[model samples]
Target: MPLQTVLVTGANRGLGLEFVRQYREAGWHVIATSRPLDEGVRARDCGAELLQLDVRDEGAIHALAHALEGRKIDLLINNAGYHPGAHQLGELDYSSWQTAFHINVIAPLQIAEAFLPVIPPGGKIVNIGSRQGSMACNREGGRYLYRATKAALHSITRSLAIDLTKRGIIVVALHPGWVKTDMGTDSADIEVEESVSGMREVIADLGQHNTGHLINYDGAVIPW
Candidate 1:
């Protein structure tokens, strides 16, 4: 049997890198993308086909789609994200907020659209989202930029799930728990390995039944 192929974005470090490592270990064909080629040596060492991709570059995205025109992508993990740090209500930087939205929300959708032709029926698209995006769970409420962008990503996930239903594509948002990555900090609740493993299990079990939902790494549904 041919190996299943998974393409992960932002795979230079942290959770993205962990995903690439784990998938490669599982004997899957891993295609890992980082913004710059130099940063992706680890992914290449882990047996992934390292590609340079800055998700913000629309032309680059289309070019990649064309380059991989005949290959089938069984899974597409949209893991690139931007967290503009915690900002006070009055001191929010609009410029950084815009950047966050582009990275966290718009880029995923654009990438998905560009790669649609390569994702066969029953293929999956997992958008990395955050629990902070859940309105029902936002009690502390300080990361306005990150939170808002993730919420928008959740919305896009739902819309993509619906729109791609006819094509038999599955789209879902996954909240990898507060993991010990650069974004999650050293004090986070879990390790990158644990979070990615759990998410991989969730991805393995996904089907039409799991479409259009926000799910935690542990297989729990999160309220949006």
Candidate 2:
């Protein structure tokens, strides 16, 4: 049997990089994409097929879709994201808000739709979401832009899970926890290895049964 093919965006760093690395190490064929594929030596060393792709770039998505046309992609990890300055509710920067939505919410959905047909039955979509995105746990006020984008992403995940079930594809939002990445910052509680390892294990074990659910890296369900 051929190895499963997994494509992960934002592969230059953080969780995306770990997914590519670990999947490749497991003998899967990994197609790692990033805005600057040339700069990611770590991803390249993982023996992945590197592609230049910015999630916000529609043309790039189409180009990539065409490049992989007719091939069966078993898994897609939409890990690309951007969190602009933590804009308070009233003082929000409208431009940054739009940019965040473009990258966090819209781009992933567009990428998935653009490549929908090529995904094989039993394939999966792992959307990188956040706990802050969860309406069930939105306590503090502030960071409206990032929170909104992720919440929209979670909504998209639920809708797509139902819409794509006929194709036997699984779509679920995954919160990688407060990871110690550039996005998560130094004071984050979880290390990158711990977060990614837990997520990879849970992700590798998820299926159609878990579609549309919001789950933590450790496989706990989260309220929508």
The number of the candidate with the highest lDDT is 1
What TM-score does candidate 2 reach? 0.96
Lowest lDDT 10-mer window, candidate 2?
86-95
TM-score of each: 0.98, 0.96
Candidate 2 structure quality by residue, lDDT tens digits, 13-34:
9888988888888899999998
Candidate 1 error regions (>4 Å): none
Instruction: Report the C-alpha displacement of residue 183, candidate 1, in angstroms.
Output: 0.6
Q: All models: lDDT?
A: 0.95, 0.90
Residue-level lDDT tens digits of model 1 in 1-224: 67899999999999999999999999999999999999999999999999999999999999999999999999999999988865678878887877898899989999999999999999999999999899989999787888889999999999999999999999999999999999889999999999999999999999999899999999999999
Q: Which predicted model would earn the best TM-score?
A: 1
Alpha-carbon lDDT of model 1: 0.95
For the record, the alpha-carbon RMSD of candidate 2 to the native fold, in angstroms, is 1.2
